[model samples]
Target chain A: MDEIPPVLLRILRFLLERRMLFQLLEPYEWWLRRKYPNPPLPQFSYQVTIHTIRNLYGRRGKIAWASLFFPSEFFHAARLIPFYPEIAIGLVAALRFVQTPLAAAEKAWFSQDLCSYHRGGIGMSLLRLFPRPDFLFATSSICHGTVGFFEVLREIWNVPLFLVDVPKQWTRDAEGYVAEQLTAIARHLEREWRVHFVWDKPFFFSNRTREILLEVEALRQRKDRMLLPPTKNLDYLPYYYEFLGEETSLRFAERLKEELSKPSKTLPHRLIWLHLKPFYSGELPALLEKLGLGVVYEEFTTPFPEELSPSSPLKSLARKILWASEILATSRGRIPGILEALKRYDAEGVIQFTQWGCRQSQGMVMLLREKLLEAGYPVLFLDGDHLDRRHSAPEQLRTRLEAFLEMLEGRGSS
Target chain B: MCTLGYFCRYVPQELLEACGFKAVFFKPDFSSPQCSSLPVPFCALCKTFISWALNHREFSGFVVPLACDASRRTYEILRALSVPAFSLDVPALAGETAVERLTENLDDLARELLAQSGRSFLEFTASLKQALEETLRQQEAFFREWGKRRRAPDRIPLLFSGSHFAHVLLPLLEEKGFLVFPDLPENRILLGEEPLSLTASPLEDLARFTLHRLPCPRLSGPARRTALKRLCGTLGLRGVVIVFSKFCDFQLYEIGLLGRSLGLPVLCLEHDTTPSFPQWETRLDAFREMILHG
Candidate 1:
């Protein structure tokens, strides 16, 4: 798939735009599901990935393009398909289809210094590869890139954009401010779509999903080994936020907990993976295996177990965004969570992978490194692009990982 | 009075002054720090701010505006390093809700500054009202003076827009026979002329005043684009020179929009806190020729 020519991709995109490509993919999806059933996390993830792509690319319904932290439940309530550009670009990068779109975006005046995920998505927008978004929604919660990226998308698509500005300090006034905006968007969406927002449905499903995720976390904590590989855990990033308000997500979470109930691989050193993993290549993952470094927990995949409220659903969403989301919480806010994860997994050290151009995450390295060191946990910093492999040197990454692993082992022996 | 420095215009100078602090815009004149935890991808302004914070001990406190991700993180890093600092969260959107949010934030900032200064509450309120009135007057006078400046017909008139504007480039642009009106946060004299009367709720009025300014690319709304277009037309500008720091997402993202909105030739140049003069000279010369000839 990675080797598929640009011309072929253009043709596929044309077919997909016209809703003919998924028909061709149906047979392939069926074969894939039969060949690799849902017990293994990778196979289950593969099934989910195909369904997500087909659903989103099929363009069967009204779609709203959103940032990572934009509540998926709003779209669910409004009967609109939520498309996350960052996740889509990550998948595209993993399959090696990112080069063309990336170049297209850069040519379109997107600086190479911006996040490649956003740049790649911009490229796709320029090329008209994705379905035309009817609306664009972004949160001021986590990454500042979303505002600029979504603003560009709004210009590209000439669609309405709703920006939910989440405040740094979580207070009643801030909650009300965000809740008012969320309610306004919801009302506007309802009027535009002629649909009543059934917030109850999303709340029910997401709450259940949250419950199961807690069970999974407890199971992982009880285990002495890594429940899943870091790369495999990263594959769940897209699905984590996008599918929260659906029954499919709930079922997947239950299955994930069930899967985690079983025993997993034990390695020399259990390390907590920070930020994002390299999605463009397998060299880092392979290196971790060779170094006998098992990732016990991933920062991006950590869940907030707090359930959404039915009475004040919008406020619940506001609270979740303001208080629960670790991405919004600066480095100091994340220290307690990191320390808890380290203790839970009995992780010997931390690997803080700084994604190229991700200032929000990368800025934390200094403070996080200091805090982690103070907590008696050694941190290894890896600098590379998660989506663009051209920025990564496998030799340099391997050397760093090997050295960190050896240090962990020496600490264990002592 | 305690002298506090700020890099962003959104930091309420009136409120700072009312609270008995001398507020001044601080521009970074240093290279990237030799040893820092901030990533290399951070905009030069941020790295330089970090470098400035580490080296300089002149300011009593630094008011870090939570305007961008880099700025927000820089605040945390400053705190971790135990620097005397205060964070004022600035909303990116412009509207009533955002104005109200900013007003509340500014009120909180006033409290912090007052606490730091140990000024009496009654005296603070009196000073705040007086300061607000004076700021509006100064801004109105500044607007009058700004609009009357004559553009030399011999030199191509251009609007300089971006997050970071190096004033050293002023002489360089002048020497190259180009008249550049810098539309950057650092040039606070060009802020919005919102002739809003000072009300009892001075913070709210100030919030409206600040937000109404020709917004930086970080802010989203029709007001900024409309303001920039109006400024270009009023000044009879031939083109826009977007001089942003390298790796700054806010300025980088605005390049396309400025070209589309301003309806003029757009020359985008990336620089650090300390820019390369020869390279800028070449770029500016070509841009000037393109405007003058073509």
Candidate 2:
């Protein structure tokens, strides 16, 4: 199982050739690494995590595909190594093998109107790159497409699918509702897989995981914030870690926080990123760095200051999940925290990535952009797909980024 | 005089009617203006929901169920705009707890509506029962008449699924000797009697009816499957034509499940908010040929 399918390896080679196009920045990267000797390589950690999970898929064990918003502690409890479509597609795209699988998904009647990550994930399964999952689970009200994604997964795998319906308002009733579902999921896993979810292992990891995120958040709050974006290729950071309940994901996060303890001096324009950055979709980040607009904060990677209450572990996890981010029920759900970040980071402008095929984040961008503009911050909805390189036509993105930079320039740096 | 709007069928229509608030179905139009940047700005229904909710001065309030991701965000956008709104957290999966939660949400909305409009729900239900019973009779008559119609023996039967009908294509399908059981949810539940007459308390009756009805893909797996099985069996369906809107996670995800569990031909049709919607011409024709020839 350790040996990869030759066809997949060949496809990877096809993608890797084009990915070499990014190597032109090596000398500059080398210089930065030389400047900051102990910085975490976000891309390196990203690859490590993806490879780790992908390897788990190859081994003989129960595999579950979950929505990004699902609690990882449950998967750990069930002894299922988890993966998700968006991140999986991203890993495939980053490896340069997204097109064939994406084409496969499209051919299998997957709509182009869905998120590209979904298309890529579905395509992966269609092309026999990603094997059918053993079980499927998802959380409602976060990503609009995840339910649809998992529904397709259920059909493919013919597995029992569980959906955790997260409420819009995080009330005590909502907590109880979700907790009941989690209990049901545990029972289902035990009956089907014939294994009990050992409580203490996940309990230990969940608490430690929260601690690391808090440390990262505190470091991010330092007076002199790093001018550079996450040095590590931080694709699916929270998701990858939380899904496996892996302490390594936390270790890397701590490394990132430790690396960014000091500011990268001053930059002309400070921009706050709205969601997950498309790390593999060409050289947008490096290009943005060159344009002198530092991403002072990112909504996805930065942890919120949450008080952990572990008296009821699952309930506490549910509380953390709600507090970590806003459920899809409201427009202004995540706005308050993001607005606080924008102010704290002294962001001159904001840019939300409208990842192709993903309606969840993109659906909220209009209100997000409008709110930022009203709050006196220039904002842009950067249209691109995370895994599909075609979304970031270098010239078009350059023009949009430049236009946004000009708008930011209009507001002279204090 | 407050005109309240709702999108999903799960939101109690009888209750809204009973509360004396004029209810509007937030229908999507092809040309509804979209926020060019927001992905699925209008969701499965389309940009019309957003444009209609944001721009229209007619509605005093909009109540949207948490059926899917897009509508949920729509609720949020409406709230942000300070438009009077209620986002009922429709449980994505069905169970006793989920049903209880939904009932509570419905109760909360009822309270809000009654408080705002100063009308008693009980009074409305009492006055509306005779009319509800009459509507059921009309529905029964329509179904009976439909069943009595003589049709060619070779006609292909399709169980229509998804959130809404591809209203424009029904005639075409009929022309092709296709009989459709329109179970894609708005008012199809009207055939069931539990909501209007099962209990003296209209709210309790509505909650029970909503929780226990033939499920849409929005509810729990077993319930949704059960609903599909019941419809396909009762209709004696030969195939399923699911007309799901673009960017609808709930409907989009259920395509494979619909195909799998029923062991029948399922032609999934996608609808965008485009003027020239991508009609599944080839697929439909192929589907027809398969069914007819078989």
Candidate 3:
């Protein structure tokens, strides 16, 4: 093969570095669409996934899987390979390969009335697109999706599965439950993997956790500041999901820090979009950018870090898991965390993207808006879908976002 | 004639009837046809109810109890659609305060219904109270009959999945030779009878029971293990029939976990509001076959 184009090479490097072709394909999504008309080579995709998995396992010499959001860092600390299915599902949804396997999973269970995420996840698993995780762990902070997803995987793969049950509201007991589950998971891993995870290394994990969270916080803060007037924060999406882990988090932090130190770019206003995939159709950020407003942060990308107390690994893990689980207790249960982000970033307004039929997020819209408003933040609740782009009221969302940004700017100037 | 839709083990039909509405309880079909079309996770009882509402236009309004997060959020969705809806806040299973709260909620519901329907609260309350009393009495009688069947040396005590079958269906199952010991109303009610005197929030108590008491298909390992232990110990159930709604992923996901946790035979029945009787009948026959042969 002749020298790959610089863009192609960058894509390949990204994929190889992430140890997954999907990660590489994620950024070059537009290219993939342009190159392959019909169903992009299934064999090729499968080969890439298999190759990535083998590489990951070979490198780590351990079986580990990272769940979405909080439990991910704990998995990383355990020295096991980490994989975020939400990231995979997000990529698939973005790439529009979600429909087929989602349909298939629905057919298997004779269910047509489930959430598309669940359908897509089941679809991905059925299609063998999702690498079989050796150990599966998820925090019940968001929805029944985590529980159901893991259970299905357990049944199919007979893999050791763990569910960290987070209550709808945060409480001491809930936190205790999380700590307990984390310990249980740790114990399970100790027995299964036969590798004793050092419980006394408190500073390493806690410090790492603090560092990652602060970095994430800084990124959100910087994005908010840059979103001042005509500037846009289009680049935040990839940075949020792709650069979350320890390996790339510091680099992302530095990049964001460097950007923030510079003189503020004049933008329309600073607004926070709630639970929105900023890169939907790769147009949201561009559209908002064009409208002269910058989306500073999203509720989904809150800088809630998962830190386990190595002093008592199991209990600490449970506590951390419980803390993580607190996310799913209510629709806007994640709002407090977001509010923290808003305060840290000095965000002016908030926009909650109420994706139609997303019960978990949709139900919390009113509560979230109320909370945001009470906190002196103006909130505009917009309804749309991530998977089915047709359901998106782009004009409506744009108008709402722009209007909110304008109000924020006016308030800021006054 | 206005048609009202509701769900649960014991739907208050008299209240609906007194308000000049035809009350219909539609169970969710968890099978393929209905599951794929729905946008939210089908595990939520409210989603199943609302999806039915969206697809069927005949319903004038919906009546739902603030039972769980799913139902509460579902009410929001309904409210947004401009659907005339009423939420009856049931007290969590705990204290005198809980009972007081429930009675107050019921009174409020009665007043709201009376206002909306131009009906007398006294008349509706009297009718509803009588109907509820009748249901409690009937349930007592049914429980005794079920107990008798369960005690029968020849009949195997069956643990019917609580999340799957409604209370109305339990009596029907008991009548059909299956000794149905559902994990909800009967077991939870028994467990929750003791009035909690502590200062713990009644809503928390209710949430706990609703979250932990009912056999949620999405329970973690410990919960699942405990449920399996309880199913084996308390019920002495020879087998379990997972009466999962068609699109409900929770129970289906738990099938393997439950199977592994308990070395028992499990037959999954994925049904919806349509009641696909023939398919269930076939599954039941097969289940019976497994019970007898295996």
Q: Candidate 1: which docking quality band?
A: medium
> How much of the true A–B contact set does each candidate keep?
0.73, 0.62, 0.24
TM-score of chain B of each: 0.90, 0.84, 0.60
| Winner on TM-score (2 vs 3) | 2
Cα DockQ of the candidate 3 complex: 0.15
* Candidate maximizing lDDT: 1
Cα lDDT of model 2 by residue, A46-67, tens digit? 4455455443544435777777
Candidate number of the best DockQ: 1
Q: Per-residue lDDT tens digits of candidate 3, residues A79-173? A: 56566665666666656555565555655652444445555566656655565567777655555555566666666566777665454445665
- Enumerate the candidates' DockQ scores in order: 0.72, 0.49, 0.15
Question: What does the lDDT read for residue B97 in candidate 1?
Answer: 84
Model 1, position A319: C-alpha lDDT score: 79
Interface RMSD of 2: 2.8
Model 3's lDDT to the true fold? Answer: 0.56
- Ranking of models by DockQ: 1, 2, 3
